[model samples]
Target: MSIPGEGHEDVRADEQKDGRKAGGYGLHERANPKRHRVIRLWTVVHPSVLGSTTLTATASEAPLTARLYPRNWRGDGVPSFKPSGQKGWPIRGQDLVRLSADYWWVIGVGVVLTLARFSEAFLVLKGRAAGLPLALVPVVMVVMNVVYAATSAPAGALSDRIGRRPVLVAGLAALACADLALALMPGLAGLFVGVSLWGLYMWLTQGLLSALVADTAPEDLRGTAFGIFNLATAAALLAASGIAGLFWDRYGPSSTFLVGAVFAALAAAGLTLRRRQA
Candidate 1:
């Protein structure tokens, strides 16, 4: 007898209905064939480090048992079994269509945000182009990380008090400003300013996207929802980096940043429209 579910809880339930005790279905000497019995002795012949031959033997009588569960179960009471409020594999495509509009909007915003921001390596190239010395280029990363670490917690807290949309919009605007600063300004000062702004953008956006995913996903499918959203954003990032690189190769560095700014602006606008509609 099986249930249309997989998990220790469902397994236990099925076992109870079938009058089987917990752990009763697992391996025991009586249930297993002789061939499955544990080996008592094994020998190894090898040369020692000094090149002398050595023979080693070990013996034990301990029995090992492994429990196996059916991957899929069927039972008359399956329809009565409540959902576990946890994600499961073999999910269907229709499950995605069942998500709320708000959830889709959040995913859209995340995709657009990812599409706008290429790899941070572009920041290093921008700094180099602005006349920052090669040896000191890593300082841009150091400054950006310091600011991101410091602000992330506080910004997350602020979002909890206010809301997600406002903070996300602010983050997108900050990213656009950062792109402009990197494109138009020159020198170490511009690099630091742009990097700092990028950090602020990250602080505002990153955690919020995860939170939005949690808020919108169905109780039983939250993990699947998160997986889908993350996969989409990761794909967007690849596209963004490739497009940025192509633009940088052909049209100069400023064109790449300009395109990023346009994408960010578009994301912010889309988010704003969604919020108003909500």
Candidate 2:
């Protein structure tokens, strides 16, 4: 009796009109005869690394950030700067300055996220085990995609309105929590929650990067400013997609998401660097 609905369980209980098990039948389960009472190590391994899939998810989303931030280096003339909003924000000047490397930190986040994308596949695999109707899986997936699309933009926008550093850092921190949840839960619901929040955090790039450009580039030089920023980001994404795939195939899925958490930490840490320097 190795748990019902799983392997090695040969009996089932069915209730009758009398409220007693009458038509109970034997469930055909092909037991692994290596049943020397020793549990398979792989079974244990899964619980230990359950959260690994989320890390994989996070790693793969890294590259998108680079594409959104883009640098332009060849434009000329100073764009007029008007004082608006809070006067003390660091990014107040990042709006008009033009430098590719100025936003390099965003590129780094992209690398880790691109790697996390592979985690998406593993997350799907987890779905297969849920015993959900095969016919409904496709529908569930479509619905979920819509949910993600709806949620991502707002997360990024919220960060911008509130403050870039705080939003970026908070999203990463929430991701860290989501990753842990992925590792600990024993069912599909865990994957759903983790992946959904993961998507929301991933969505932060568009607004965050847009603000990065706004804060740094001069109005007169927006063309050159955007060009240079985008180029570097594209390069990081190219590397992240290729290498992150390799990492996922060679190691386990969870390893990919784990790497994502590390990169997120590094990015969060890097955000601090600008404040100290300024």
Candidate 3:
């Protein structure tokens, strides 16, 4: 009884009522029970297809992106690849040995400097010995951290204007003063002074040392350089702390800091000599 296209028109009207259009598919079309069921079945059958395609496309573009914007990839304005225009994986052993040989002075300086840096726990213990109330002992660390945060930016800026060597020498001098104050100076006054100097020393030297490493190392082997630098310093720090603890138990806390002061002075002198030579 219907015209030839009347049934099709009726189906289209029903689809429109269901919020779907004849020419295009969208959220409304997907909301249809039949279409939703078919889509779910297709997804189940090809679960990884979409994911694999997306991953492949990203992986393909990553190298090109790294090449185009090497600094962006490195995040430190250093290029992402070898500097000699050679393209290949670097030989780790040979490169590391060469790096160590070329930068042995930096490594040696780091070791000497770290040997003067005993654990902060010793500082807290020193505060206690200086008659800081048990409850207020934590104030020592708070004061140190505050000074460290305040001075870090200024110290880094100053180093940028002058040089890393001068800043690092100043830091070593600060550490020597801190050690002397903690060891020889009396009372809570000395404790606070020592803690503040300790913070200043940290702010002046830490970033500059890392920057020095970055400046000296090749772009391709920076990770290795940093790794080795950290390892050397960490080992020295461990040994220094252990020696300090030994001195604390036997010769007493004052002797511990005196020994630290001696090391700091020696390191500072070494740095000065190197600076003059350069």
Best by lDDT: 3
lDDT of 3 at 135: 99
- Candidate 3, residues 1-278: lDDT per residue as tens digits? 33465477887667667764544456566569797788888979686888888788876454665676666577544455665675676445688666844366788888888889989999999989999999999999999999999877777679989998898999999999999999999999889999999999999887777887887788768888888889899999999999999999999889999999999998899889877877
Which window of ten consecutive residues has the lowest lDDT sum in model 2?
Answer: 21-30
- In Å, residue 253's CA in model 3 sits off its true spot by 0.8
lDDT of 2: 0.56
Off by over 4 Å in 2: 1-101, 104-146, 149-157
Query: TM-score, each model?
Result: 0.67, 0.51, 0.68
User: Sorted by lDDT, highest first, which candidate order results?
Assistant: 3, 1, 2
lDDT of 1 by residue, 215-246 (tens): 88887688778888988999999999999999
Off by over 4 Å in 3: 1-93, 100-102
RMSD versus native structure for model 3: 16.0
Ranking by TM-score: 3, 1, 2
